[model samples]
Target: MNKIISALCFSIVALSVVAQNNPSINQADTARQQRETDQVLREVGPGDSVPSLFSEEDADIGPQTVLRKKKPTWFRGTADAQIFYTDNMFFQDGNEQEAGLAVTTVEAALTTPPCITRFASYRAEVGYRHQFFNYFGSDDVLAVPGTILTRRFDAEDFDFDSSTAFAEIVAQTKHYQFRAGFDYTRLLGFEPLR
Candidate 1:
């Protein structure tokens, strides 16, 4: 019957769509775990040395607490003491002039939550970043390259400030994770930020 054939076609198409989407749901969470496993495998099996940054015996785990922390991990520090400067490089536009821009960003995190078995745990992270730019362009043009103008000023406005901040809560188990966060961004448009 034609109705049966039509139903079969629709079912095939629906199955195909679901099959395509299911892999991506698992891909993102599994990616980090797979990389960690590969790093461990390479270090132990091939004599490839990967430095263990933290001592294993120092992990803090409570016997009576809800979490069973067999392995505790923690790291927090920053190592950078340098200045950066950049001049006009040129992307594309009629606006042309020398420029100066500087960017400085700092972030840190501490994840020491105990585990609720081999399958579940809670984690949180917080970070912030900021950037600034000062681009001065010329709108004055002379009839000749060396010709002088009585008074010159550019009639252009430029974007000169940007910043972003983020905080995330990550609760995860063996096969899945739930994440919630607040993200604030100030990285758009040429309007002056006050």
Candidate 2:
């Protein structure tokens, strides 16, 4: 009985030592695992060729071409004329006094692009207006104290002319704007002066 028990223990110890010394079993197990993984991959089929998320082809997707608008010119101007006629002039108290009036106006302006370093813009403008009145009548005399009142039949005294010139500089930013300018006006043959 002792010999049998001792032989059994010896065999168990030898088997464990052999298992540790021999690496073939480990290699076989690894090989079997690799084969199983390959078989599973083959069954799954080639995964749909996933395109790169940041590929260069995607750069051309939006707004293939840009459209540009034309810019306007810097100078502009306008001119106009008007005519008026009446058989009975108001000053003649509804009498047969033919009257005619003509008016003309002209305006012009100029603007420049903003400067690079200071971001300032410049503008200049000028305007002119003229009025001519004609009346077919005789002169009238009035009685007054310490003053001579003489009214001419022709509308020469009623005609007027005006002109204006202006220049300005402006500085602007995203939030605010600053402007400075100078203007001059002239008038001839107005009622007060006449």
Indicate which candidate wins on TM-score.
Answer: 2
Residue runs of model 1 more than 4 Å from their true location after superposition: 1-92, 96-100, 108-122, 134-159, 170-180, 187-194
Q: Give the best candidate by lDDT.
A: 2
CA displacement after TM-score superposition, residue 54 of candidate 1 (Å): 20
Q: Could you tell me the lDDT of residue 183 within candidate 1?
A: 77
lDDT of 1 by residue, 1-194 (tens): 99999999999999999987897777975787676755564345333444343455235431222123234556443433333333332433543344443344444556555444445677777766555444443355221233464344442245345566767878787678998988787875546547
Go through the candidates in order and give the clash count of each: 0, 0
As for candidate 1, its clashing pairs are: none
Rate residue 190 of model 2 by lDDT.
Answer: 48
Clashing pairs in 2: none
Candidate 1 shows a clash count of 0
TM-score computed on alpha carbons, candidate 2:
0.35
- TM-score of predicted structure 1: 0.31
